[model samples]
Target: MAKKVALLQGNEACAHGAVYAGCTFFGGYPITPSTEVAEVMSVELPKIGGAFIQMEDEIAAMASILGGALTGAKAMTATSGPGMSLKQELLGYACIAEIPCVIINVMRGGPSTGMPTGPSQSDVLQARWGTHGDHPAIALAPSSCQEIFSETVRAFNLAEKYRMPVQVVFDEIVGHMRERIEFPEPGELEIIDRTEPTVAPEDYKPYDTQFGDVAPLAAFGSEYRYHVTGLNKAEDGFPTTKAELVDAEQRRQIRKIEDARADIESNEEYQTEDAEVIVLAYGSTARSGRYAVDRLREEGVKAGLFRPITLWPFPEKRVQELAKQTKGIIVPEMNLGQMVLEVERVVARDCAVELIGRVDGEPITPTQIMDKVKEVL
Candidate 1:
């Protein structure tokens, strides 16, 4: 099978990626910058015998996807900042219920109604803490159209493997930007389905498994019936208020992701082998940071690039390793130093951490990053 190359916007690639990942359902609302994701899904899903729905609002959209997943369908929803904010409570519900679903949260400028068509990476922290409580957050950010496709598939895989929600985040820049994208042939992508209960219907436990941290799922309409709730649930999936029961359930929720820490973390290193300075970045910011590393190299400065493909679970171990080789770390972000603080925490003064940030909806260019590099030196 010859691979096809298409000039696609990031959102379009995301929709295509969902299909390749075996998604049979999409529930979303139309909002600027991210509405294209829904538009593409609406057209694509039906052709493949899947479903597409536009709900009353973001809340209903979020709810619909959860319903779809409970029916044993690969499901997803897409939205921007304000819409994403509306979906938080339900997002928390999906988390507590151990539902496997994908959320596509496109970045936009906002605290509330700030900018509809602007690009901002302010939502990175929100994606980490928006839902509330001490739950695991698995998020992946991609910089290009091709990556948007690949990462969306990876997001679905992670969600199913862990039986929890996973977020594929991109900013306004990548969401609307068009570029060439290459898709792998059919059967080439590594698609994984949720595990089904080996036990009979009478013994199904959605939250508990003797097999591993991730329990087998019993679809709602299947013979295997199980209870699910937003309240902290014990192994049986019913609401519980007992302190020890709640503690055990919460720890299992955290441990499922924490225990799979090796699989959930991803990053890329460029020219760091003999470099004394490293510039850490992600999403669209890394595009410029890539050029900054090259420019510094041409000027005889030993600068390298560190990009996080999976932003959450933070990739702390890798940064800690790099901290031993560098004297300074520079972080460039679209928000005002959100991830820079993360870098500082990991480096722990083993080196200097500098931040170059922008919030005016304008991109922080490569020259700006290079200038920051010089300033730090």
Candidate 2:
């Protein structure tokens, strides 16, 4: 039986997604544009027998989620731009520790508290390079309320599957928008749990890669006790400064995803195969890009959309392949051309790469995109 309900705000749907993905614990500090996620989690998690805690600050919020995940809980935390900044060091910790957790960043204007309530897509680069070191991450952006819920589930699944942190990056517009959503029915969705250690506790090496690319995880306080630190470590999970060991560990961390790229990527293309001009947009701007593509089609011009659901570990091969056929690529973003550069680099053939961007907290509308399509054509 399917049920239709009133529109859900994106933030609320995000919280629902986390629950559906089996998140048993949430630790976060409230901040504008993202507070609703915490608010809903507070009410819903307790009712469902999950733990919800409001930490003293964003740093504690991040640390608490990592602790929860270490104890075998599906844990997550949500924040906005400023809060995301505060959580960077711990973000890196989660990466190195290989903690399976989800971090939701509902973006607002930034640098440092530019506009707490306003929408901004300026976090694209931050989500990639915010952490200090060289660690790969998975980031998903939802353009609508339904995606907010669906992608949240995917974030948790990806994190647990890969034993790493995943990010759900949304902006204020999508976070606050209300839209009717129909969720999946029973048995339609697949959930993944973390892999457990197979070796005996006495023989277990926490970071051992003998079994496979992903080393099985043992929960904190388990008989298979081991230490986890941010510094590069050996198979036993002890801090090591050896260059060769460091190289191997780093490659293992990166290759876990690189080797499994097929499972990690999610994207969509509309009328792109036969179109000569394509628009690569993401987040909220994608909605308008769709409209612009439709308008161009109506005016006898061929335009298509390429939207990346997984922002990091970008779909480089796919875009490069598309570039071989397309004549031009127009990238529209809320910030001033961050992702465009990546597209240009990957699609380095004869295709022209164009940018349609704004950074003053104003949205790029369908009209502007339609015009850009014409200009690029």
lDDT tens readout by residue for model 1, 14-67 = 999999999999999998879999999999999999999999999999999999
Worst 10 residues of 2 by lDDT: 181-190
Local accuracy by lDDT, each model:
0.91, 0.90
Model 1, residue pairs in steric clash: none
> For this target, which candidate reaches the highest lDDT against the unseen true structure?
1
- Candidate 1 stretches with Cα past 4 Å from truth are none
* Native-to-model Cα distance after best TM-score fit, residue 106 in candidate 2, in Å: 0.7
Candidate 2 per-residue C-alpha lDDT over 150-192 given as tens digits, one digit per residue, 9 for 90 to 100: 8998898899889999999988889999999777654456788
Q: Show model 2 residue runs off by greater than 4 Å.
A: none
Clashes of 2: 0
